[model samples]
Target: MNVLLVSRGSTHHGGHDAIHRLAAAATETTGVPVRACFLDGAEPSLHAALDAVPEHCEVLLVATHLPPDRYLDTWIRRAVAHWRSTRGRRARILVAAPLATQPALVTAVGDAITGEHTTLDGNPGPFRSPAWSQITRHRRHVLVCRGPRCTAYGADHVAATLGNRLKEHGLGDDVLVTATGCLFPCNLGPLVVVYPDDTWYEHVDAGLAVRITDEHLRDSMPVDGRRPRDSPPL
Candidate 1:
């Protein structure tokens, strides 16, 4: 059986590299070819990774995360179910317990925290990428749900299309796009919630996402018939 390590990916380049390193270590330790998949904020998301798996291979899925995020656990199960049902494949997907639940983690943490080890006192600089030209100038935040349903339904494509459209229209500075966890309405995904206006759009696709960027993101005129009814602001 092949192994797949799923992680909560980071936007920072170094953070992403660390996840890759973790996957490599797992592969070395297990003597099995391992693949990496991200939860959010990176390419080759869990759905994409699953798609890359051969139709006949059984997979042992390892969540390489600590603290056991409930959202990730739920989404992982859902993604596996969706993959099996949609593909109608015989691949056996078995989920391993999260790394945090391993007894060795406690000892490892204890060993790492030696008596001589202590944090240095210093002021950390701005926690943002320099490539974000208008990081401090964002007028609105666009939250895209990257839940199981949303990801399976093409939320990644929606995010990419929305971002590109915003940049093409020179609205990137005004709007900041964020990949979020489940928005509570998984069935209505891929979903997007814009704030501080709190305008929520459900069942969004690349075309509808771009339309939102053009109408609501650009001029604050929310597209008609997309917003959820009676839903509170997010």
Candidate 2:
């Protein structure tokens, strides 16, 4: 067995520690060659780590935290495709928690490979297609930009306020609020994006945040006037 561990930093802690722990355990249990990939924006590409996997080794991808949706999906698909095309049919794919919880990951891997999606037992229905869609539809997404300029202005307060308000509204589970490093437009100090419509807001404050919850989040109204011209593609 050839195990490949990949992890990124999370809101709570960096994923490197968890990846190392898993690699150690796998090496002990299966005596397999374990390769680890720890990304902190200051490390090498994951491909470098994948390239280190020994020949004819079954690949296990473990993620300690949820990764950016777009990038993770693309990588997993590419990996599976490469394995299928070059490594024969003996290659097996396994993912650990957090990434395992992501519907997109499960769907992409399941669609690309053969075999049931199981944790330790039967298939995890929660990770199945329909269930995954429902979970995603209801999962709240909050993106806060804490770019250098934004941090200088007050992006930290914006993130804290949003998180506090979400908890107060009893919508914490339905909301995923995060303060990201940058969203470009460094001049715009504080910025936020609320999905599934990807509504962008600039110069956000507490009062505006409340309105966001009530009008846009609660009532589903479109955010007015603050959308960015270079907003991420839908």
Candidate 3:
């Protein structure tokens, strides 16, 4: 048997380091092969973890979220099933209950709050800063979804490719890119939403990202069939 600890993943370096450290500690403590996987924003995705599992082994997926995401708890099974069907089942995958469902967390939080932890002595600074107002004006802005489903569907590469293509086309000054969390209708994930036009693109890939950057952003022509027909007014 093996263990895969699943977290929501992090956008920063420290979070990835912490996940590996915890996985290593768990492996040493249990003598079971342990690995870390994420829904988005990092490498070693759930499918990748499954790929590394020994053939026919019983693999346990442990959900490590602190506050508990019910959506994740539900979607995980469907995601794994899809992986299994597409890649051929190599192991028996089982998902453990989320961390929040454990009764011990209540006691843990209560005990933690009792400790005298250090606190800041005073207000850090003014709410507003001059640097914030100094941002360059841009014609269009894009929000790329980095949520679980979108990540699994390859949003990272899409975002990277779009940025690179924009730079190549010398349109970086005219377009701004940002990565955001879950933008649902995950069925059409790897989504990219462009504004002030308010166009939402579905099932975006690296190639499509580049095309969108060239046609919609640079040439000011929206890509055909990106926006859903049934989309409600925003």
Candidate 4:
């Protein structure tokens, strides 16, 4: 049996690396092929990962949320069932019990403690943060999509280029850049959306990111967003 660890993916490669280490550890102990796949924001999405598994071998899926996601437990089961129904594949896919319900959860927490720990104090909620209450005075808001498709296409470079170029062009103070999860129309990613006027750009790379910093954010002209493609069918 092959082990597939499912995780809530991240835009940063470091996040994926941590999961990879976990998968490697599992493979070492279980004496089986163990791999990692993301739910979103990283490559080899759940569907793509599922398709890669050979039909001859069964897959044992394990979820990797430490505190456990509020909805992931229910969502993954339904999503997997939907995939199995739609794909009609033969190999068995069994989901391990949700991480939240595992008896080892409490034991794992207890084992981690070496130094003294403080009791829970839930006062001063997230909304109480001073930064959260304040709005940015920046002139433009730029959103860079870090969804799985975009990341696969090099959204990380695009994002970094935007930031560096904006600072170089002296637009950093005037422009706000945010790396966001899944700005849709994911087919035309690495995607960038600039607001106050909602100018959308698709298939952006480092080159286009620099262009956006110079032409759109700096000059206030929405850069050319289309590629050399003919009109779509009506």
Identify the candidate with maximal TM-score.
1
Report, for every candidate in turn, its global Cα lDDT versus the true structure. Answer: 0.80, 0.60, 0.83, 0.77
Model 4: lDDT equals 0.77
Clashes of 2: 0
The full ranking of all candidates by TM-score, starting with the best, is: 1, 3, 4, 2
Error of 2 at 37 (Å): 29
Look at candidate 4 and tell me the lDDT of residue 118: 81
Task: Estimate the TM-score of every prediction.
Answer: 0.75, 0.40, 0.73, 0.55
Evaluation by lDDT, superior candidate among 2 and 3: 3
Candidate that beats the other on lDDT, 1 or 4, i.e. the better one:
1
True lDDT of residue 99, candidate 3: 82
Q: Per-residue lDDT for 136-225 in model 4, tens only?
A: 799999989976557656676788788888888888679988878886677798899888767789899888888898988999877886
State residue 97's C-alpha deviation in candidate 3, in Å. 3.7
- Weakest 10 consecutive residues of candidate 3 by summed lDDT: 224-233
Q: Candidate 1: global Cα-lDDT?
A: 0.80
For residues 138-203, write the lDDT of model 2, one tens digit per residue.
565878775434544455556666767777778767767766766786555567788767678878
Instruction: Please tell me which model should have the higher TM-score, number 1 or number 2.
Output: 1
Candidate 3 lDDT, 29-62, residue by residue in tens: 9999888887776667787788788789999999
- Counting clashing residue pairs in each candidate, in order, gives 0, 0, 0, 0
